[model samples]
Target: MAEIVPDVGFLKNGKLKTALLQHKALSKSGLSERLFGLMFSGLVYPQIWEDPDVDMAGMELREGHSIVTIGSGGCNMLAYLSCQPASIDVVDLNPHHIALNRLKLAAFSALPNHSDVVRLLASENTRTNTKAYDNFIAPKLDAATRAYWDKRTLSGRRRISVFDRNIYRTGLLGRFIAAGHLLARLHGVDLTEMANARSLREQRQFFESHIAPLFDKPLIRWLTSRKSSLFGLGIPPQQYDELASLAAEGSIAPVLRQRLEKLACHFPLRDNYFAWQAFVRRYARPHEGQLPTYLKPEHYRQIRNNVSRVKVHHATFTELLSEKAAGTVDRYVLLDAQDWMNDRQLNDLWAEITRTAAPGARVIFRTAAEKSIIEDRLSPAIRGQWTYLAGRSQELNLQDRSAIYGGFHIYTRTA
Candidate 1:
């Protein structure tokens, strides 16, 4: 594999610092924010959490629609290709995410077949995956992306070797889930038992018998009281506050319990891959359970054919939007990022969204709180340009298989 000195300066990247540091250096919130920045600097979401099916439906995606979205783990962008979007401009502050998105595009274009791509990306088989990467995917990657995968870790393993193991088991989210399993084990609870639930009743029974009791433990309650404890879930200080606020007594334990319950009981384990990832630490096999929309077999050909339409950039969404001509983009997927923004950041983002949105453009996002984050934060003039589809947002939020978010929002550019 091609090699280079590993680039580890992403934690200090100015854009990330500016976005995450909203408090004083010595303050409690500031320290939590810094910790989150450090954790988020590395690969965070091994698999993006937002449900692409809900996203596509909310955007009302149409053939040839131009889209601009944050590239977290790159799943939704690939899924959008199945809808035949004309172009997708993906931006992220994390360089790792930029590289991951580019790598996925290359894998789709260069891998020999759907099965090879699936094994390399969605499954664990180190030798075959590493061989496939060296022979096929590596040559297709851009210089920057190839370098990212080829760089050696502290253990001296090439970054691409993650695919040889389980790539989903290596990132911050993966570590978080693993930690959750460990915690449950310590409490004599087998969280993975939720996956064995053959029906909704069994799922609820397992949750009540096993998962629900963990939150009531004194240790679990104390640990969750700290805002920094949730950085593993990619929840920064601001969003943590929002989640805590949802609980009647300001305890995040109840909030977490409710979310986990929705994840476990709202959908059948056989159909909800989000539940599978939560309880099983990986997606189900092809014959075992449903997969993400992008990973489903029927969409493979369309994703491959449309892979060339994606362009990945390492930048903030506002920065990327400022460069676009007015009335250019037709769809926007914000992915709960607004939860991390303050009033100024929210206004600035809406300004760009309003300025660049084409007629009939649709914007969809999620919130950590039960209501829209932009309710009164956005300046009137900019906010007036869009209509909030409250009914549609609620309907879609209910259908979101990844049931972690408190709310899903949709805003359409006013004619």
Candidate 2:
């Protein structure tokens, strides 16, 4: 079977590629690094885990805003359309992700109504999605993207069959989530029971009682301590190192414990589709209306109306930024891509971003480590162009329902 992700060469020649080769070699051995590299090379996050609502709050988009964001699963880009931005340029190195973003826009444009759009994306019967894609979306897509989804997978099924089969359940994160459920079962915990908990108090009780104890087990500690075991969670070797550095003890288990606690207990489950996905592995019952902001019924009209505001590219953030004229971009969402970059790459990206940023333009990103990577790695001249909104960033981090990233940063153009 052809792999869903063919390569992780988003940054072709650099320290990043060197690290990828080392990780790929490690993958040849049966541990997690190979899987992480393979997954990183493909569609990893079927549904992005970041909190778009928190991102929207921080962006404070005005009518004239033009934003640029990394298109992971294309969820947040769709969510931001509701803010009525003038235009949004969504870029990613993964062609599949660019296709996903394109598919979303086409669906919104072609579907008869909002409910049909919801049924196509959120419901289990992929026939709805497949038919929708064939009759509605396919004609609108560029030839390259259409061919991507039309290509058959290992099963002799067209890649679009993924949507028909519950796309959210397919991808590296999906398989990883399935593994987590399996792990929980071995420890006498039912993740679904935690998912269906009636209240936040019940949620907290379940985590403390049923889930928390599992982290203390020898097996989990052993698994999580290895950098390879976390590939499903989309942690590259560098990210794993950053996460490991957060603790003086260097045990990822404790960090995992804390993040899981937040995922299970921090927010109202009725409202947090992220938690439902973590525990139940699907969005909240479609009837109950728990979904990502982009999938919510209330925002459907605005999103569909504004879906045209987005333009997608299979390109890196720096490459995309370098093409724009100075002082043109107003908002940026980098989504942990910085963690993958070395100092030279960081400096190059920030240089373009600095040149392209409009007055008061804002950039937000997540980090695998708790510290701001730009502070130490970026040249002082490039870094000085932006002011770190440290207090607000930390506050947003606390409220992030995804509860996985170590830090969420917000930086504003100072001049």
Candidate 3:
């Protein structure tokens, strides 16, 4: 059997345990589960509030081109569908995210109408929605997903009970965020109110006063130093260590706060839907508005049809890339997965990326350092075929949800 690393960082003695416990309480989950357990603990979805304008600005999504991407929350996958790609192949290691993506596609495909789909999935109308799930969604689900929603929690409510609950903070990252909120609250700071700020200046002032101070606490600083505390955010231990290594002083929280601060301070609150998800458990909805643009009426049919283009499995990027035919994919969205790689893994991934990418194809991903994550680490032959657009990535990166990331990179394969 392949190695399954139990996330013992949570169980490490006192200070870390307390921080983890606090985050769990705030995210609304009672306790942190093992990495695999965390994936299956709930529906585990990211609120689909991606900044589409930022994602599509520089790239040209031509019709009839196949694209391969990492299905983080599956938001970007749907967003890309709006451009009408010939196909999109989405991959992820987490089964919870896979189930959530499948459910979303099913909702788009089988729901009676656009309005019904929106009300059932986006709006808070669960009492009537269960009928929709049963009639349209339930029968279509494979056994695993059907069982996931049917399974009861300790309180005797099914996991589907989250439909009526504030599910924004329900996923693995949500739990970490919840924990961060609680730890901040322990020191007398509340982030929930930041969502109500009427102006950008007001929002900036609030983050400066409340959210920024938590990073200064010695206890929080110490806890943030360890890579394992980040598992709740879906960052494995190796990525955490790489991200921490970027800091000259070996401190990560301040650098992370700075990047996040840019997301909160520079961008308009109305456009920054990611901020809305992090601070408030919801986004602004027009009276009977449709779902996010990616899930809109126009894109639903195509995204559902393209659903088979995506395949989810438990494997690393290198393992998956090894199976691709040479010169196949046009776009690769890594999303900082390389930060988890050792030198060999990094070499293997780039070798595959180099082998699989066609001329002018783009490979985009984020990292934990301001510099390119592959500097001096990749084989010269593999690295030479690519041109990294550092400047453009820096510009689009200001819109990313996790302010904790170091940098975003877009590399184009050349002949």
Candidate 4:
């Protein structure tokens, strides 16, 4: 195992300060270093991306197309495999994310049955899972993962102890949400009751009472105004800037409040799975303890089989895209990743994207604002070759799960 060093200076006095200072027009090098710091400090998570069911629907993905995706946490890639893609390549800069992806693949590959896998991951309780880990998974893990699982935190248990709790809060964005909840609580707000509202009106009332007070706080407003501070929320600095810029006086609280209001009030609590994860810490479960639609029992075999079709690599998008032969990939799921790139990186990435795209290949991704990042950002020559399906992408989006995403987009290489 590589000996990990604690660079306390970076967190307390380094690029974090630079990021906060130049929140709006963060340079490429600054953004890269900040992201690397986030990855190293474990502020970036194994699973901070949005639900893939929402993403796949937005992409309108069909069978027999290969995809390339950023593997923040492995959940979405597994979700994509359920649709029977020809292949998927999961890329990440964080080794921890790769470790988590490998763990998911290992579980699917070696679990005794689908039931055991569910009992471990989907259940949110790891008692049975720890037993399963000890008996089944622990011995099989590679040295790195074994060390990750074995390392103890200040709480005395291993980091693997997180599986027993609402482990969603362990991720980068999850930690931000947890902190937000704490801050909200300090202001006499309780987010959990947004669930008990019986109607849209009731939901509105709940938010007004329970969620709105934090937005009024000076500290919350100040922190919300800065884009780079939101890296803790798993938002890239660029995307955070765009979202912040959309509001009057560059106040982000109103924007976040409005979007979160939509997530909490626009749909039934039982149906809005994002709210379930956010407010209640678990999704509504049937008596049999079934997972979400994208993670049904029957998909396990297919996911396990298609697991081989995907490879998780710890590298940047440009690095991986540079190695692939032109016209080899059929689909690309960028998942709002482009918002993190600077002009040069964007150009390099799209250059490879244009070169690697097969005829009629589809590319899908989300953004932090309600426009395609590729439109103004990509070179005109490259952008002209890919036809954007503006009308189709809008129709596929579900308002409930996707309230936080700026917008979903799908593009196809010109035939």
Regions of model 3 farther than 4 Å from truth = 1-53, 248-250, 287-292, 296-315, 399-402
Instruction: Give the Cα error of residue 103 in candidate 1, in Å.
Output: 1.2
Q: Pairing residues by index, what is the TM-score of model 1?
A: 0.97
In the order shown, the candidates' Cα RMSDs to the true structure are: 2.3, 3.6, 6.9, 4.4
Comparing 1 and 4 on lDDT, the stronger one: 1
Model 4 lDDT per residue over 1-415, tens place? 1322222334653323433333332877466546645544563654545657666766667788778888877788888888888988888655567677767777777778888876666667557676677778777677776777767888898766676665666777676777877787788777766657667788778887778777878988988876655777667656777796677876788888877877777776655566766675565566422345445777887887777777776566667788899899887878777776666667888889999988888888887887888788878887888888888777655542647876778888888
Q: After best superposition, candidate 1 residue 302: deviation in angstroms? A: 0.9
**81: Cα error in model 3, Å:** 0.9
- lDDT of candidates 1 onward, in order: 0.88, 0.81, 0.66, 0.70
> Taking the tens digit of each residue's C-alpha lDDT, what string does model 3 give over 1-415?
1221222223332222321232244342333323423343333456533355555553556666677766667677777776767666666555556666666767766777777766766665357776678788888877776777777878998766566655566777778778877887889887778766777799799889888887788888888886557766666555655666766666688776786687677756666666766776565566312345665677767766665555554345666678889988777777666765567767887888888887788877767667778989998888888888878888877656545566777788775
Encode model 2's per-residue lDDT on 314-353: one tens digit a residue: 6678877988999999999999988877788789889999
Task: Quote the positional error of residue 289 for candidate 3 in Å.
Answer: 11
| Model 2 ranges off by over 4 Å | 1-35, 286-289
TM-score of each: 0.97, 0.92, 0.82, 0.86
lDDT by residue (136-193, candidate 1, tens digit) is: 9898887878998998989999998989888887788899999999999999988877
| Model 1 lowest lDDT segment of ten | 1-10
Q: Which sections of candidate 1 miss by over 4 Å?
A: 1-11
By TM-score, how accurate is candidate 4? 0.86
